[model samples]
Target: MSTLNPYCPDCGAAVAHPHAEGCGVARCLFTGGRRLSCGSRHRADLELDHACGGDEWTGRWPGEAEAAEFGWWTCWDGPGPEQGWDYQGQGWVQVPEGTPGAVPDLDRLSTDAQWDRHALRWVRRVNR
Candidate 1:
């Protein structure tokens, strides 16, 4: 099995070892306690203790446009009924959640296919 290394999911930085006396928070490594640092800094304690599952991707992709452009769809309908489009352009487009993974050959698929593939891959990566 692969060992899980704790790192700052936000900045992808390695976490420093926690001090000898653990912080009251179960997973915090900083003995000084959790405090907001530079906007770029992410506290391991806060992230571990307070963040929920959904928080993992909180700021990673914050809006619908970002989701759509990057090929992310929260639901199968591709954001909404109006926005939905199918691969063949024949029926109401419905991009299912957990759709096919992103296609590296994006130039080969239609716009709808590209978005569907990318969104599925994004969701899978974040969920993992």
Candidate 2:
């Protein structure tokens, strides 16, 4: 087995430590792409409270439009059937709990594919 490097190759920051500003390898939580700053790089507000204010992307997620445009249904915060921006409907939709596409319990997801499918199907938030 290969050992993992504990330091960031671009900024020399230790693993689990925040990367230096503008570090190339820093991963963006919103898109899983490149992090633009030490702060959360979101399209909605541009910056989150901090890097670790709940890793799940909020309903104000930057990727929502792009995901809908590309037909990527997955949501970072697990919208379930209760709330989400429906691409087909072209409006934010909400449903009662226990709806057909309601997010399954986390423990029920036993595989990576299952987890991915769950994320892809759900959305976030409930107005009620």
Candidate 3:
């Protein structure tokens, strides 16, 4: 199975990499993807089969283990060479830019202000 692209959780912008720079707006939306209304998309999962080598980060596959829908997963790392899952298509398909709830105009955000964590909104930061 092929993986999908990663997107910003807040504004729905496609994030080139995990922890991509300047994304104060993303929130995780993978949970919504599991619904039938959201296309009932499915992805393969790696069971940390152990044979894949140790956590030493040798950077290789799990030898004999093939792709299986064992569980949910997503790459926090950049796109893997050719793994079943990457940061993008972890366990759900990437919803397009205009997914209803997505922020249509990122420009409105100046980044001059901070997200008012209390109200869950962004407010302009005025200099003292």
Deviation from native of the Cα of residue 93 in model 2, angstroms: 41
Question: In TM-score terms, which candidate is top?
Answer: 2
Assess every candidate by TM-score.
Answer: 0.17, 0.30, 0.19
Q: Write the number of the candidate with greater lDDT, choosing between 1 and 2.
A: 2
Which lDDT values do the candidates have, in the order given?
Answer: 0.30, 0.39, 0.29
Candidate 2 vs 3: which has more TM-score: 2
Q: How many Å off is the CA of 16 in candidate 1?
A: 38
Cα lDDT tens digits for candidate 1, 1-128 = 11234544444433343222222222211221122321114444333443211112222222223345545443222333565544333332345335553213222123333222223222212322
Off by over 4 Å in 2: 37-128
The local distance difference test score of model 3 is 0.29
- Scanning candidate 1 in windows of ten residues, the lowest lDDT window is 52-61
Candidate 1 Cα misplacement greater than 4 A, ranges: 1-42, 45-61, 76-128
